[model samples]
Target: MDLNIFREYDIRGRVGPQLNEATVATISRALGTFFAANGAKRIAVGYDARESSPIFAEIMHRELNASGCDVVSIGMVPTPVLYHTVYTADVDGGVMITGSHNPADHNGFKICLGKGTLFGEQIREIRDIALAAEFAQGSGTIEHRNVLNAYCLDVVSNVKMGERKLKVVVDAGNGMGGVTAVPVYQVLGVDLIELFTKPDSTFPNHHPDPTVEENLEHLIQAVTEFEADLGIAFDGDGDRIGVVDEKGRIIWGDELMVLFARAVLRERPGATIIGEVKCSQRLYDDIEKHGGRKIMWKAGHSLIKAKMKETEAALAGEMSGHIFFADRYFGFDDATYAGARVLEILSKSSEPFSSLLADLPETHSTPELRVDCPDETKFKVVERVSDAFARTHEVITIDGARIVFEHGWGLVRASNTQPMLVLRFEADTADHLDEIRDEVEAKVAALIAATAA
Candidate 1:
């Protein structure tokens, strides 16, 4: 089996090429062995609407059963619903077959033991077991369950739409969010305008990722036409969210986090809130000003979730729109639940979404910038960049090297999933931002050349 499927946080690969039936079976057996060794007997399985997901789920179910772990298959659903099953059901662990925001051709598994993610060293250990070709012989049972109704009800239960009923547009981007979000919103009495709500594995409208500005055109246009209060979009697996306000302005993940943090802090003063490295400096400053402690953490959903637990944070969010709430909700990244929470907070307030963001200090910034590098050389490039910055600049190596200059900050980190260096720069002045971007780009170019040499 190709060991490359085992990634930093989850297992992912091209569907037919690297994630065929035999490979998936082997992976399932490895997971089962890991669970069995950890004294876990009951495993729940869930999957997204991707074309290959059902196939993978079947393979996973068969293999898990063969390894003597009773399997409860939850059919096609969002990743969060699968996560909720682990929290509410009797299952010892759960696995979801989903590519998340990736292209349809890609598929993967996100595993959870109890309420926490199975990642980092545990993922590596799973790889080691797979590489060793170890297997346990036995046969367990397989059953099916549907958790969509329970999940939907749980999400919309506490949402207060108030008397300020407003039209809202939702662009699910042909992802699994449509399957659950529409029903919940309808029940909550929202004047819902749906876009790409149909679950098409091909993702005909756009890639399911809502982070990129280009992917948000449909939602923005719909929001403008409908004069909606807000527009919400979800990634493929329905774990990440993107939002547009009444003026059709795209509210980025960091800004959304700030709004949520303020609302969360109102109820729990001096609470801890964690944000990923890519979040804006304004988010941290504003949270602190609002009597909440902010902790900057490494980027990645799994990493942020673990950090949230460590800090006992009331809330945490990534620049990628992966928001986790431990404040009267399950501390997991559920985009549908997040959308309801956003509406709940908005309903209780009189401020417009854009106005809330307008109050923050403005800074010129680039969204996440990607620099191509090979998987083998990505970390080396970051190290070289970090070492160079260490000699002449105030560099923070919390995740990558975030070099703090007088005018702004620049960050460069290797992506965990892809062979690319992610870079972003922010500054008070446009000229300062440009200069910082240039400096970082030049340093990255030199690192590439050195690697070639």
Candidate 2:
């Protein structure tokens, strides 16, 4: 088996090439063994709408059964629903077969143990067990359950949009969000315009990831054409959300976090809120100014979830669209529920979404830019950049290295899931932002040359 599918956060790889039946079976056996050792007797399994997901789930079920664990199959659903099963069902652990925002050819798993994420070293242990080729023998049953209706009802019950009747457009990017979100929106009494609502693994419109500007084109166009009050989009597994205002302007995750944080602070003053290091400084300033405690943590969904639990944070969000609200909803990232919460907050206020953002201070910033680097060399480049910055100036190493200068801050961090260095810069002025960007780019180039030498 190509064991690299055993990633830091979850097992993910190309369906046929890296994640064949044998490979997935081995992973299931390994997970079963790990859970059994930890006193787990029952596990939950859920799959997305990917073409390979059903086959993968069947193989996983067989392997888990062989390892002496009863599998509660939650059928095909969004990742959030699978996560919800872990809490609502009497399962020791749960696995969701989803590639998330990756391409359709890709499919893998995200796991949870009880209320916490089974990531980091836990993921590595599964690899070691699988590579050892150890298997446990037993007969366990696989039972199917449908939690979509219950999940939908729970979401509507918690989020009351009040009397503000607003028109909203939702672009599911042809993922599982269309299956669950449509029902929930229908029950919540919002005027809905659905785009790419059909569940298609082959994402005909665009890639499911809404964070990239290119992927959000269809959603923006539909928003403007329909003159909707707001536009929302979801990633493949429907755990992350991207949003646009009524005017078809991309609000971005940091700005969205500010809105969510503001709403949460009004209900619970001095509440702790967490944000990834990649978030804008304005987000932190705005939260603190609004009588909330802001804590900057590392990026990645698993890391952010763990931080949220540690801080008992009421709300947490990443620069990407992974927003987790622990206030009225579950702490896990649920884009459907988050989109509802956003609407609930906006619908209560008379001001337009654009005006709410316009009140904030403006600054020049670069969206996340990716620099090509091989997986083997990416971490080395980040280390070199960190070392160089440490030698000359102050740097924040909370995630990678955020080099702070007089004009602005420049960040260079290696993406955990890809072979690239993620960079972003922010400054009070465009010229200052450019200067910081240049300095960071120069450092990166120097690091690359040194590696080649």
Q: For model 1, where is the 10-residue window of minimal lDDT?
A: 157-166
Q: Write the residue-wise lDDT of candidate 1 on 181-275 in tens digits.
A: 89998888789999999889999999989999999999999888888889999999999999999998888899999999998999899999998
RMSD of candidates 1 onward, in order:
1.3, 1.2
Question: lDDT per residue, candidate 2, 1-453, as tens digits?
Answer: 886787878899998899888888889899888877777889999999899999999998998999999999999999999888887778898989999999889999898878788778999988888888776677889899888888888888889686888889999999988777888887878899999978899999898998998988998898899988899999999999999998899999999999999999999999999988889999999999999999989998999889888889999999899999899888999999999998898788787778888878888999998988888888889888988888878989898889888877999999887778899999999999989999899989889777867
lDDT of 2 at 412: 95
Using all chains and alpha carbons, the TM-scores for the candidates as numbered come to: 0.97, 0.98
Candidate lDDT values, in order: 0.89, 0.89
What TM-score number comes out for model 2? 0.98
What clash pairs does model 2 have?
A: none
